[model samples]
Target: MTNTLEALTVPLIQAPMAGGPSNAALAVAVSQAGGLGMLAAGYKTVEAMAAEIDDVRAGTLNFGVNLFVPESDPSDPGRLAAYAAALASMALELGLAAPEPGPFSDDHYAAKVDYLVANPVPLVSFTFGLPSADDVARLRSVGTEIVLNATDPEEISAADALNPDAIVVQGAEAGGHRATHGQAKEPSESSTHELVTLAREYTDKPVIAAGGVTGADIAQNHFDAGASAVQVGTLFLTAEEAGTKEAQKDALLSGQYRDTVVTRAFSGRAARALSNRFTERMAAVQVVGYPQVHYMTAPLRAASADNPEGLNLWAGTGFAACQLRPAAEIVDEFRSL
Candidate 1:
């Protein structure tokens, strides 16, 4: 594992937004602008991730791949059923039958690791949980720099024990799923700056500040707080190269959403999304069954493809400052800070 922060012309890393916002073209553009671009390997097959890696490689080698470590304990079956029942009405609204929960899969974690070992990239990061010691060794043996995400001081201590090259300090304000180590534990509410300072007290590993970073000044504040680099995801959702759906982009740009809240209603894992009809309606009834609840709501989300109010509009608190532009321009703007 290596620290590529010093080699970067812009000490910024684009957060690997797992759903549709992330794409090869967007990653390449950020890398071309002298920042680290990343491919989100979550919710994708091993082959699909490899194809995207190839696409990014075609433009630049300064890139990384992010993956979700498989959940150790399966989500409670009772919770899955309960959540499915709760989503039945939404399914009916979409002219579909009652939602059925599916069996949990490991997200092909082992195979994706194997692929990365065989085709090593400059960096590889893990969210949800840290990989096994042997897995980390194997990836490092191939010259792949490893980064692990941490939400609070306790998680930072856990990540330090793994001895990764760096740690992504994801604050509570981060968009998308909170990278808590286990599904059962409640995530901490430390801000990005506080997390960065807290992490420094535990380890000397590079700290990459993530969450609510909107512009140059905020990113600079993170650096001043001892972060090696700043990672931004929401800011790039509107980039020309992004694969963000039109509904999501329009909702974000419309100024209709005055605030964002962390909700498990959409995916059963705590994620920050703009307040909408789905979040409001299902807030009280949702359960903690990640991929299961995520799948159960899939048909409804697809059926409401054109309606932003029915879908997950993941965004950080700083989303209001987001601008529609090219990925390169976004990275360049952060660099100039």
Candidate 2:
């Protein structure tokens, strides 16, 4: 409750990577290593996420949970329908039927928030968008410290209005989905260094820099650039304890993926992912909706799990620095700086 930066011993945070990357084992390992480990609750049922939280508590007490603030508006059904048809082709190839588009759910925002409020954790961070002021107040009433993710100066200013305990300045170089509040808003092209610097100029709150940070050198660079700490997601993706799929793990290590690209093909919302066949095919065909596109591609993604070329292997610009080792060792590498 009202956790401080000191709750994170090494000032290194294991970024909350959703969609099967971040897991209890990875989080507990990072926390055990004297760093803050975060559980990604995006795309998970409230019950499943709570079970994972219980597991994390059993492993380590110092940890945080990150949630995706549900999209404010559902995507156009027609657009979602069209995207579904495109994904259906891949679904059929995988021997799976294409799922029909449905009304978008908030990924159980109310339930998850209520759960956390009733059973508070040491820390809670929000991404994709900021939580409602009432919800933020409710969590704070229970003494939970709130941290909001922001990608640019405007978003940082917006977060300041909520008076969060801390802010994560996510740069464009960040892996996974860009956390811009508006679905249609363009993400800033600034590097983590520049974003952190700009965010520092706007708010006095503790700023945690996220994106493309693979090692102590990169972490130190962010610290020097005015970040109080650095959040690294891709680095741990290759860690032995990470929940990253074997295919995704292979893709990161595969020299075949020479560069990472920001694409909306996989999840609709623009996110940084390893270049793959799916990304190439759906580049122009994708829609601007979030979980709708996210749900539409679910079947294709599941079917393509075996084929690394077809899956959305999310990674940052520093993916090449990823290593296959214990997560604690990965944390140590960043903490040593």
Candidate 3:
């Protein structure tokens, strides 16, 4: 039998933190602990996503995969060239070759949907944008529950048009990329609770609240605001089961940073990350182009894996609550009373 969100005793959904953190181990641990676990399919090939899905399948049945929806030509080629030129000196300092923008990709969005349609899981959530009606129908045909992420009123209405099983109300406080559907628009700065409340006016579908989920108190507030489940990503950054890099874990627990700022420095998309040298230096030069910007900076980020200042330390506003502990314990902290 396919497991549904209603069947979850703990109404908590682990936010799929792509690029790292969201992994098979983390997903399985949280699912086994009675919360819904998620695997991020962003920046991964279809074969790799399939492997992680297989791993999660081995451990538990209550797991989901998140895909980054493709967008149209989001940035000008001239802007990318200028950005690459700006990154040359920094790359040289890191002993890396200057990055050139690669061809635009849908992040293999079509192939991934095909893979999911053939082998469905209990649920599938989309970030960055919503899938087409045909794509949603194909996935649903295989018993996969569809979930879409929306950042504001316009997005909520757009998501509703697709008739997803649920919608993730991602607010400004969300870490990683804001799910604005396009790079041309500014991200919403509403609080998570505020987003959930506002979303009620648009869609009648179940709401999964995300962004800055601290603990029971915050989760309870979201529940009161009409959220059926709360999705947390930052709080789990230090989880033992997560694939968070050492630099990020240290930066979160080190207490060296004071605040998180949203900038397109890392991915050309608005994402909240800890204050760092890279974000500061690249902020002015950052332009709007997703995988293009993301791929251009991959080498720099990879080389700076040991240096927090040079990496994208994605974290939410409530990052202070992050801890290095078992994911099960974290899930228990958000259980309904």
Q: Report clashes for each candidate as comma-separated counts.
A: 0, 0, 0
Provide TM-scores for the models.
0.98, 0.96, 0.97
- Count of backbone collisions in candidate 2: 0
lDDT of 2 at 255: 77
Superposition TM-score, candidate 3 onto the true structure: 0.97
Q: What is the C-alpha lDDT of each candidate?
A: 0.89, 0.86, 0.90
lDDT of 2 by residue, 1-337 (tens): 1265676668888999987778999999999998888999988998999999999999998889999998865577788888888777777778888767745778998999999999988889998899999999999888788899998899999998899988999888888899999677778998888988898778988899899887788788888988888888998899898999999998888778887889888777889998888888888788888877777777677777789888888999989988788988887786666
- Scored against the true structure, residue 114 in model 1 reaches a CA lDDT of 97
RMSD of 2: 1.6
Candidate structures ordered by lDDT, highest first: 3, 1, 2
Candidate 3 C-alpha lDDT tens digits along 1-337: 1257977878889999998799999999999998999999988999999999999999998889999889754688899899999999999999999889856788899999999999989999998887889999999999999999999989999999998889999988888888888887888878888999999999999998999888989888988889988898998889999999988999999999999999888778888999899999988888887878888898999999899999999999999989999999999998763
lDDT-better candidate, 1 vs 2: 1
Model 2 residue 296 lDDT score = 73
RMSD of 1: 1.2
Q: Residue 113 deviation, candidate 2, in Å? A: 0.9
Task: Estimate, for each residue in 1-337, the C-alpha lDDT of model 1 and write its tens digit.
Answer: 1556667789899999988888999999998899989999998999999999999999998899999998765688888888888888888888999988866778999999999999999899999888999999999999988999999888899999999999999998898899998776777888998998888898899899999998889888888888888999999999999999889999889999998988888777889999999999998887777777787788899999999989999999988877788998888887775
| List of clashing residue pairs for candidate 3 | none
